[model samples]
Target chain A: MIAADGGLGIVATQRAVLTENGPLVLASGAQLPHVEVAYETYGALSPSRDNAVFVCHALTGDAHAAGWHEGARRPGWWDNLIGPGRAVDTDRYFVIAANLLGGCSGTTGPLSIDPATGRPYGADFPALDMADFVSAHRGLLDHLGVDRLHAAVGGSLGGMQVLEWALQEPDRIDRAVLVAASSRLTTENIAFSAVARAAILEDPDFRDGRYFEHGVTPRHGLKVARMMAHITYVSELSLAEKFGHRRDTAGHDKRLAADFEVEHYLQHQGESFLDRFDALSYLHLTRPMDYFDPFGAHQGVVPSTRFELISFDTDWRFPTAHSVRIRDQLAARGAAVEHAELTSPWGHDSFLLEPDGYHDRVRAFLS
Target chain B: MIAADGGLGIVATQRAVLTENGPLVLASGAQLPHVEVAYETYGALSPSRDNAVFVCHALTGDAHAAGWHEGARRPGWWDNLIGPGRAVDTDRYFVIAANLLGGCSGTTGPLSIDPATGRPYGADFPALDMADFVSAHRGLLDHLGVDRLHAAVGGSLGGMQVLEWALQEPDRIDRAVLVAASSRLTTENIAFSAVARAAILEDPDFRDGRYFEHGVTPRHGLKVARMMAHITYVSELSLAEKFGHRRDTAGHDKRLAADFEVEHYLQHQGESFLDRFDALSYLHLTRPMDYFDPFGAHQGVVPSTRFELISFDTDWRFPTAHSVRIRDQLAARGAAVEHAELTSPWGHDSFLLEPDGYHDRVRAFLS
Candidate 1:
């Protein structure tokens, strides 16, 4: 929450009980007894609450989507795209970004205490699906007395959640903007995630997700997992352009230090992630994306929700083909959808960055 | 060294002194007092010893390129590409396959005993370069009384060695075929290898590469490393075709069991690697490839050796672009060079299989 001495410019995080009811029933027939969502907002809500734009954060993201936090070194994660005079101008639209369900960033997730056992759910955390993620997102909106959404903008896994929320609440969402998202995961995609899961699950310190009580975490396995994932997040061209040929690697440096520039960059990414992310949260978030098959039955339709899907040219993670497929599926189901494959060297991470035309396109769609 | 049980029908593995000279000096200035190579020869060497063709192995490969090991369940790794009348026809040319230096498969590597201490070298094994691999390969040829090679063929890492050998000894090699090979590793390529190295090095059982005394190996790290590599070795399309979709995964299966079909396949690939590979050997072998820059100085030339570089359409590991670059380089250096981007359902592993028009192209090139 914004401190009592809250300043005018710096935005602090706020928490709210997502649901007014007792327990939230998940799509998997599981029940979350208590669900609290952490959120950050910018600008003012319209008198009718019709200008509320819900922004869904991607995997590993928190409610701090924009604006500088008090005493912080830098602004929020997407501070580049969502601020005053920015493409996602806070002056025009009231933006609401929340920590999604099954997240460790203040949302009631695996790290949250179980009311019955009075212990962190840990391995006992129930399985979650896209609908469950959407449910939590909508619950936060309900608590704020918002009846409809002006738009829902998300990227990567966040994009998946937006798609789910838009599809389920067709009439409530006017514009559903999905950036570098997938309607389903491919065998290769699952294979990559499987390796990450193996690294964490097989770690000796993991102790079967109950590592919290042991005062140690699966840092090694999680680090490897993050390093591998970071490689996929950025394109080959971007990595080369960012850090060109570094020839400092030793042939038999049994220690395997961060010899190459790219290795050093990846090592930092992996190391820093351990401080903010929980192994269980990672497992919870990524697994749902692997099994996400919204168009499996071709029943996913959103007639009232005009869809705007943007994909990066270099994004092999969820390539333009994935956007094309999503477009085709939505169009076939009689939903209005527009898609674009933008140029960027940052691969799957292009959506997060202000890649040339990316911000402009999103702004144009929002307006 | 082929045992008495070896019959005329089955080509059994044989061991020979790679170098008769005292301590073969390596490119890195490190010397090995005794070096032995495990090799297998198919067909007969013609008089004048001019019909000899060298076959180099890729990462995790060995001397068993073709034919069956006495009681083995399967033929060699590249059995389909070599044999009596396969593309690498053993009948027309005497095909010799040898495990490369720093290899764990019956070659003097990290697991080999040090002459001075009489203990496994482990981490003490000297560093290696492409030139060193070529030295060992040439030594094997000298032992067989073969002065010049009719051709040298390899895929992936093996293909890199062939390039180095052809450049160093242009006149000695008549033909050099490099399939799915890279002349130099890109930043992204090295990043992947770096993650693999991290997984193996940070393994608890690694013990600074002296795990031999502990009677334990870095199996967990090695398994994770292999799993990640296995994903890159195959294409997204191929993986999708092989394993469509099996969605039995539980989000919080905290155990991270092989619930998905692809997960099961990857798990099998990772687990099976531990049985045939060594951790230090994996680290040593992969690191050199990251630093291989034969064309960096641009003095590399192979005037007499006709070069044939083949790349698969789906092989993203070392895509057709890698072959095109190599082709342009060799052609500019006054060398006879040709390259083809072949169609294959498989990725980098396509070299070991008989894809449509693949075997025919090789046979015609060899003839």
Candidate 2:
């Protein structure tokens, strides 16, 4: 158990192994002999196990969703949303957060050892779809004896999972909150992800995802990938307001050193991301995000599950059009779906930035 | 002279050396002892030399604005708008297109030898500004015996030059056409350029812009930079229509290979750009673009040069707001200015793509 400031004081990320069914078959027809899921519980499971709220995370997020680790100065990525009396309100409901299937945060991913070769899976890790991620989450829920979830909520890539959960097993989730996400990746999304993957792969140290064995990381390539992705995460307005044409006070040296505030900010973001994330994991995870398409086969059908779709006006990544499309799809089938295109200059990251509007919507919908 | 199928049947790039001047003073407070300008001319100069139409090229453009070069498969970059009877009409006006001061083509730039060291300027090249570019063009005009220009026209960075031309020597230019560009770089422009520069600098091969001495090129870094910039050149709608989530027929290799069509397109753009552009020149040119702010010093005053502003609706790089701002500024100062917010899915490159509307407007104004 770990102590946090505002949220559940005690939180622990526990692991579950699913090995009873020989090997788990992935969407790509590959198999994992055994799967290990790392999950954190914010509160005690309800007596009936019906008041459980599952929180999924976006890319770079992990099971540490609401608390402070032993030596950590900052709380989890979504600590602002999940706390004692916050949006999710751990006091009334048991909250569960898990590291994704193709993730680096304590989850069995590319960095994990392969039983057959006694080496990190690396490039050998099977391609996984959103269904595989949901399946692994199901393994954890089944192990915890949770028959049904009160709600499944997430934003961005995490939100993709929330939609997948409702589509894959509607009865399992009573409600779903998908924020700043889309049912499928847009062309722009695929384009951006493609460039990012190229950056990592082109790095000399990458060695076809064998950088770990080479005793070096593809830090330069990964930094470039992060820098490219960071541009899409924030709105132009926000970027203009935050950085603008403002040069670093140090003055321009006419060299490679960052002269603009935005450049310095991007450099910092890229460098910091390398410390916590694995390059291979980023590649593995982003592929499924581009491949996710639950409505591909049933474009005209409306999902029966109740949904709350939220999008920020400034979010060009997953614009309001995506949320509106989902809302219209559900509404077409007479299903209950609420969508709000909230105005925020924070862009796609508005979900994590504006607490009042976003929290209120989540709280009201969840209640 | 080079033969061509359309427009002017024959054209050739000419060079002018400005050695008579002791040194060319730059906005950065540095000096270049000598400067050479590469320029191309179409049609004949009028007896009075007042029928000259000065054409400025964009970031990736060159002095070859119209007509074909010897053994070249394609015509000039602005061939569509500068042909015999086209918008600028080579038959009606003497068109002058000069490579920018810090450009890589045949112009004096980072690749030029520094007389003092007998080595390429590389990182040692003095920082330049828009005014420096205009100064070089002015020198070319003086050498050509052109006293005044009927019009100064350009799009994107070229448009920056057009604005600078009117601002620096208001009496020399009778009119200016600024298309899909602004008087200064926006915050987003600076941010994008910063990332591009960072990508080039971060590459190990860049060698602090001294890669030329090592007989190596920072192609990887330059490619990444081009890929990032290419995304901004087109609209999201255009990208979506041109290259959706359609994957390459060769199947995903689960590696860094281009899977999506957009990835393939960006890779091609990046690779092809490496053959024609220099990394140091890109760095040098993009800096002045960010630092360009002609209105900064003379905000309240608008020169008497006639102005034509064109912006595409989808050009988020230099949105209609930018053109409108310019229009408003010029109009408030009682300058003759015409602004058009045209609708086009091509984004910032619409000025170069939509020949009909853009050319018609230019033809009407210039005629």
Candidate 3:
């Protein structure tokens, strides 16, 4: 595990997955080479390296999974869910949380330099996929001398990777947990993602995705997309309960003034996210999530793959029905599988929120 | 009733009860003087004038309620629910479906010329409320020499105005039918409306709301707003059943190529709406709906107002819960009220779809 330092926290700089003929060509007609994956490790790696668990992050998630960074008051992204005695149980297993390949956090992504142009990939960053992301995670595992993982757990986009890893390297993954994950991108999902991408692309400061050097960013566009995305992450009942006609939201820092507490919460979530995330990275990640199709490559190849799938009832983004498709397919293949839809008002983001009884199910399933 | 012409059928123009001081000042601060409401009359008017029924339209809805429009093949927005012997039967009762006061469909709205400035009010048009809308409807009724209405039925924003009319002029309207309507804007609802407004305001072509003269309307903003609104109009289950992950929607004339079927539907709906609606009027009508609060205005005032509310099970926008609130409020006020949530997958637009058995309830309630 990397040691915590300064405000930036522990930066893992050891993993270098670069190859001689590297910077592979991407679907967007761009090349990425000299890739580096900065990731964090939790718990101790067993002698067989079979106790390792990989935690895939969502669209806005980072590599940080638990513990506090130096000078930072907050813990990791899944701090509550992946703590000493939490669901992921870092104390009981070695956990790896790596920044995705097309991320702006610590890994090599859009902000990383292109060797050929000697500049950041920016808009030129090659369009990516679940394969590229999982490959990068594999690269990190190779560097760490870990050949296989005991389990892969993820939610939303992270859940996509879990499914990808389970299919891509079936023998390498022992157990897979997919939460509110879809097997393929539906038309509505793709449309929403397209709108989000268009929002950033239309921003004047976007600079055709070169906004970083231009001293301007498509903050407004990013914020709008984030706001839109936030709506899909929650349920109407929760929104009604939280915000319901309370329109006092005036000036900044006023929480209760929300016309609907849900709107205020979403607006705040969107605006705050824009500040920390790179628009291009956001575009890269969301598109892949939309294009994801676990059935495409695998086809009828592995009908009987072991799987455990869970979804929240109120999650409309990737509803419970989506999870059922996976379970059904796996069952058709005669694979060992179980599926459950937890009663939750947290919607698509339920996996992150530590609502009562949710973690209990996670622990029970993983146990 | 003014006869339907040029693709608009069975239209009626009424100078219903006009206030001497009206064209009242709108939210845009422009006064709409000598207001004229273009409506369509269906069924027969009882000798007592107590059988007159008024049906209001949504933001982009037109006055033509039932039957075919001249020069056009399609029927009115609510044609599915209204016809010669439909729910609100034209043969048995005099039905009035009018273009709202602030609408662009042959009514006095932002698109109308401000005689004072010799230009369309555009964005300069003052916002409106259910009060202003009902007043305009009242004016049209007065001109028809109707002292009372048997019932007022409307859905969405139109339903909102129905609620307002029942409360504001309780004596004028004895029965009210609100479908998928809310008494007050939820924060989430207002926030979504705010996002739509911001989109319109952000467009450079909007030109401070004076795009009509410059021939540069904020089509993109309007389209985006409409797209956003469309998401709320349909149910998730309906979307899954209709579009799902199907990629079969591809053709030159079909919208499938744009993205997901849902997105294509939204884009088409939004784009088509911009052609017939005024951007400013969208704002004007939406704001009033957002601020429509029966209890806020007349707390403990009209609790005894008898009302009938109906909602569809799939109408997520104005879900059955919203109707229940109206019923609960009316009941709390000791007003005779009944409400039902029809099992339909049409979402908030079901009021126009006329699901099976819906007309029977309406007939029983009115009779």
TM-scores, one per candidate: 0.95, 0.96, 0.86
Alpha carbon lDDT at A222, candidate 2 = 89
What is the DockQ of the complex in model 2? Answer: 0.53
Candidate 1 lDDT over residue span A186-223, tens digit each: 89989999999999989888898899999999998999
The lDDT of each candidate is: 0.86, 0.84, 0.73
* Rank order (by DockQ, best first): 1, 2, 3
- Kept native contacts, as fractions per model, are 0.64, 0.50, 0.18
TM-score of structure candidate 1? 0.95
In CAPRI terms, model 2 is classed as medium
lDDT by residue (tens digit), candidate 2, A44-161:
7878888899999998899999877666777788888888888898877889999999899887899898988989998878877787788888888887889899999999998989
Give every collision pair in model 1: none
Q: On residues A45-92, what C-alpha lDDT tens digit does candidate 3 reach at each position?
A: 988777888989888888887767655667787776775666877667
Interface RMSD of each: 3.5, 2.7, 7.3
Residue-level lDDT for B279 in candidate 2: 94
Between candidates 1 and 3, which one is better according to DockQ? Answer: 1
Which lDDT value does model 2 have at B91? Answer: 78
